[model samples]
Target: MPSNAPASADNWWCDESSEYAFMGFSYEVTACQSPQQLQQDFADIRNTFNGRYIRMYGACDNDGFYDDVVNAAWDNGIGVHALIWFGFDGGNQWQQRRDSLVSTLYSNPKAKFVTRGIQFGSEPLFDGVLSPNDLASQIWDLKGQVKSLGIPVTVSELAYGYQSNGGAQNVLDAQDYLNIHMLPFFDATASTSNDAWPIVQNNLQFFQENGGGKKMYFDENGWPSVTSEGVQANSGAAVADVTNEAGYYQLLEDHCSDLKNNAQGGIGWFAHIYSDSQEPGYGIYDTNGNKKFNFAPRTYC
Candidate 1:
């Protein structure tokens, strides 16, 4: 995922006074050519989608990927929710990550203008690499450092994780907000694209009921058009893919239209992505920046 700098509601999708307060997307830069290209992409995303926020999955690396994203986002009036990678890195690695973040903020005098908040990691508990208590501790520890930089801190996890005993007592209590990744596609029980909202609604209910009613932010959600080999063999193959561009289009339209008004009652959502990637068939934009036939609903674009 990636970002754009913060802008007034006038510049974003939803009206400032509207009940629908947030509309955002996740971005990745693997298909970008240079910083200039990446910057233009951010500008295009803002101009085209009217999205105010972008979520990046991990910390900046020596390769300058995160650097390009931050610079582009700041220039294009987008807010970024940065996530730090914390699988098994040691204390030194964590310090380095912190240094990189602090440096990014310090170097950008106007960082407060574009920064939304921070997440300690994406799906640490869902992946089973970290226990619920461990994720809670990370959030508790990192919250101070993030606050020192003038940003809020939280962790992104599968919505179901929060329903667990530890999730309710530990994880929910440690974070400033709830950042959940709700991909019903991964659920064996989900039988169709239409099955998505019900799962999303249920998860939101779980968060609201067990989470002490913290604000909700869906870090990821979307349907893939093609059933590539990896996902094709999954248990829900019967409804895994929408099968064609038109079906995929309707799926997006229905999902977005319904979600805009908190239709399913989740406060807000970030569409799964901006463009296609190695993950296959999820991009709204092709590698050359061309919109797929069903990229977005007509009015949305």
Candidate 2:
């Protein structure tokens, strides 16, 4: 929590709150949930895990929700990073929404700690929503605008499968910080499989080589429930998922250890809850907010 703490113990990237905290869900932001309810939920989560940060995705039209969540986080001593979802139109509507949100924070300096810089776009490469070059341009422009307001910025959820050259290169060049979500399950194995280790290692190496001096954060990385889709159908078929929760925990511990020792920046996991709707289950906690069967891991470093 202390700003001067060592990066491994509790600095911006490798802090205790970020390394051990979970990214909160965004589905709870629908119109159904009132602002007050959202605040209460934020409080509950803070008390439940003593979380220091919460990741939230924001729609261009949902400025009110953004304001509510930002204020709630500030009141509760929780850091809120808003993922700004932009459409293809490239209109002022999205810009206006962003401006308003940033303006709100600037107007209320007390809430500065509650809100972090905007996440330009999520997984733009995978979604095919924006070309790498165009994405870079947009990110640069957005960062410039936010910086004009004195807000630091980062690109959230960059697709790791893409090579770390060209447009991806441009995005890193354009921003003050770069963030990547390393979902190892996309590799041959979800976690237990040997493929997982190298996949992460290679990605870390690439980021360090290309990210320049800019900080890189592992915004999202975790294993999901094993399913048939997760398995590889190669000459020798291998299980796609690691059913052993302890293996998953150990994988994280080892991975974090390596990340702490190697990566110039920091690393953090995905959600507290893993969803079965997706191929590989990706929740650390069940639907009811309870730690899943094999979710326990030693927190002391």
Candidate 3:
């Protein structure tokens, strides 16, 4: 079948061979999968997606081992944005548990080489898990401990979280560079992927200014291909179809010049996910590891 994007399949493949095509992808560690399976997944992250980095949503499996994940990523020649997973500020156990993993990886020779930085938390303000000041202080303290390891620290939040008055201003102030989410498909103004670029352009300046003039990236950009029932889904006409997903990514390819140049104080982009077979249809690769679209990001249009 043909795609709905402006370009045909033959013209859709971007210059993914460029290291600046995309900074990284978001991935998780599954205990059910064997070490070999995880290794292949990391290989795909580097080779297939041309990702230089990855933000892991998971760390340890049942035996409390995180080395497999760290080693796979590093061995695959991809840097890792290690997660500290601070959900709902209940106590210090979450921090302490992750502390053990960092301590272990700290000794690995690859730690300094492939560990990009430690993402202290993901959308804590959006989830109401921590106050801006609290999360900022936590980022401060984490950087303090991990300085010898030579890892920077940051937190992810929605663009609105950086509101100047009472929002997560401190969180923005604490991060080394801004890591924010700006998903256009969720906006009512976006009827389809073709409509998404305008939304991104309209918001980029606001996001940049509110972000305090630091380097930034849209870490959770995504669009679904379909609904869970295997039918088309719609959010004000942002239809969940493979073609729409292709169209959304087409914009990514067209806009990569800015990222590659690091122009206007931007760093890179990491799409929402690599593969999600369960629901909401945002996976580029399906459960059987088949890529749904013949798409890649280019450094220029």
Candidate 4:
């Protein structure tokens, strides 16, 4: 059977299969030429995806631009599930940026139409840029600010590397919501061992056991078909072709299964910047907005 073949209702990631639901795609707006243009693009996306929720981030520190994007999403009836207010290029002024973001959202009810959750920082622990307690405290403070504003908050970190060293525990202790970014790249050596699933499982288990009963979310997860350095082995040798796309789908299905009951939400790959040669093949839609693969065709049971 074809790998892209539609999975049945019995499939673990299927809408009827479990409680954990997958949020469609997390969009990046950096590629748009102008804020208005970006807003228009988002409007089209919202129409195309209809009921699915989309996660999005702003390009510059322009509140107006962010507001426009959010407004566009809302106008089209699209849900702007999560607002990644800070840390696009690893710049860590989370508190300041988040304050600005919250202020902007509150000032405009249209912007607030689609958002309540905020992603504080991305990959702080992996880069050894922020200490565990410090990161946790940041999350705590952000949550407090959002709650004081009468809205809920969520904190997301880079996957694999960021929370590798007790950072997960700290995040759990400090924040009620946890976000994980997951990317599955094929490695000849690692792929055989089913390394990806184990890592995801362990992280979920750790979070559940450590912090108070906070919810976990696979905030960002995807498989990339092309790499900057080209296809290579675990030892960095050139490989034949991009690993099977079917394998990618299978991995997603399995990961969704593991997160079925526990995960709060999920977001699939993405649909922008389809031409980044370095990270090619990651887009679910092509540069012209063609569907690369229908990973999830059904949204609900």
Clashing pairs in 2: 10-15, 224-281, 225-281, 272-285, 273-283, 274-282, 274-283
Residue 36 in model 2: shift from native, Å? 3.5
Estimate, for each residue in 101-207, the C-alpha lDDT of model 1 and write its tens digit.
Answer: 75676566456556677877667665565677776776777776656555778788877665543554687788887777766666666656654556666776677
What are the per-residue Cα lDDT tens digits for candidate 3 across 24-138?
A: 6777553345678767977987787677777666435344345666667656877777777655555665677567656755655556555666777666676666777777898
Q: TM-scores for all candidates?
A: 0.78, 0.73, 0.81, 0.72
lDDT of 3: 0.65
Estimate the overall C-alpha local distance difference test score of candidate 1. Answer: 0.62
TM-score of 2: 0.73
In angstroms, how far off is 95's CA in candidate 4? 4.8
Residue 78 displacement (Å), model 4: 2.4
- Candidate ranking under lDDT, highest first, comes to 3, 1, 2, 4
**Model 1 ranges off by over 4 Å:** 1-22, 30-33, 58-60, 63-65, 87-95, 163-168, 229-234, 242-266, 295-301
TM-score quality measure for candidate 1: 0.78
Better of 1 and 2 by TM-score: 1
Candidate 2 structure quality by residue, lDDT tens digits, 1-301: 3332122212233333334323443322324346786677678657765555666543535546666776677666677666666544555455566677666665554445565556776565655656778777887777676664445677765445347334377777776666677655555444354446776776667767877855555565555555454333332333434364334446666666555553333544444232332223554554455455544333334
Instruction: Tell me the spans in candidate 2 whose CA falls farther than 4 Å from its real position.
Output: 1-32, 58-60, 87-100, 107-110, 159-161, 164-167, 189-195, 226-246, 263-265, 268-280, 294-300
Better model by TM-score: candidate 1 vs candidate 3? 3
> What is the overall TM-score of model 3 with all chains considered together?
0.81
lDDT of 4: 0.52
Best by lDDT: 3
Go through the candidates in order and give the clash count of each. Answer: 10, 7, 2, 2
